[model samples]
Target: PVKDSTAAIGLTILLFIIPSKLDFLHAFDKDPTKRPTKPAPALITWKTIHEKMHWSLLFVLGGGFAIATGSTDSGLSTMLGESLSGLKGLNEIMILFIVCLFAENITELTANVAVANIILPVLAEM
Candidate 1:
């Protein structure tokens, strides 16, 4: 292969010129113990990782889903849809744009996934 030949020629040139001109290989081997070493960081164990992580993520997600269901079932979403539809003779596109803005604002106030979980079901009902 052309790649292998090129690499072989390059290595041959390096071996000849470097050892003959500067002798770098001899100098590097003359001192080995004088190099500095960095200490390794402590490894994480399963027990430590489990202890450090809070398990409330499941509860938060489940609660968000429940809240979404309740909000939809109570006709809040329908009211929101009707109210927004009255905004200066809003069309579908304008209503969608406003909804997107409100959705972004809610996501900024709360965590994004949690807000999305709540919003998606409500949006579907609307």
Candidate 2:
């Protein structure tokens, strides 16, 4: 949050001075023998490059299709429809805000798969 240069400098000084007297803690000390003998040579291989390119595209396409499939399921659609019914009594804007808040809260506590599975059937029923 240090915005201005002067304020940032002052904060930096304060932080460093306050921490100067504290002892430093570390998980482990370095071992010289374990260090690599030479800098690793730059990798240059068609197979390695091809594998990375291949898998990246494969996984991306696979995940995209899986998400699309999950969203359009009939039971899930029906459940969502049921839950979304009966909005006639409430203001549309307020309803949207409330629904967004509720959904955010729910998503925070549940995984995507669990949330989708639970809501899909319920929505379809609507």
Candidate 3:
């Protein structure tokens, strides 16, 4: 229904803000049928925020970025690109299949972003 990017942003902002104003956290109460009668305490407490955050995911994302940067700096992406250049004459669907198969296998071995960083340059060169 959103006609433009600005409307989409506005709708997203409204979705986020309206729920807090309406005591959305009450849905987490132990008794599902009973509505919370009292005003909810501050939702953004340090403990709550810390518990909700994925610390492990942060480390993985950081590692992925580091790997991407290292690969680019070491010309690894370029080397990979050159190696795959032989497949340039393949049919589009076949190329797509090969790329998907390669991506799936590589992603199983490492983080997806890392595999993407390593493979995107190769695809671009091709």
By lDDT, highest first, what's the ranking? Answer: 3, 1, 2
Residues 9-35, candidate 2, lDDT per residue (tens digit)? Answer: 686556544533212222232865555
User: Per-residue CA lDDT of candidate 3, range 23-58, in tens?
Assistant: 566668788766566665442445665789899897
Which stretches in model 3 have alpha-carbon errors above 4 Å?
1-45
TM-scores of all candidate predictions against the true structure: 0.40, 0.33, 0.61
- Deviation of model 2 at 54, angstroms: 12
| lDDT for predicted candidate 3 compared with the true structure | 0.77
- Per TM-score, the best of the predicted structures is 3
Taken over the whole model, the C-alpha lDDT of each candidate is 0.61, 0.55, 0.77
- Give candidate 2's total backbone clashes: 13
lDDT (Cα, tens digit) per residue for candidate 1, span 1-126: 579769977875554444232333344464665332433223433466579967788577666667666656787655665665455466768867987898888866655665676566545655
| Local distance difference test, candidate 2 | 0.55
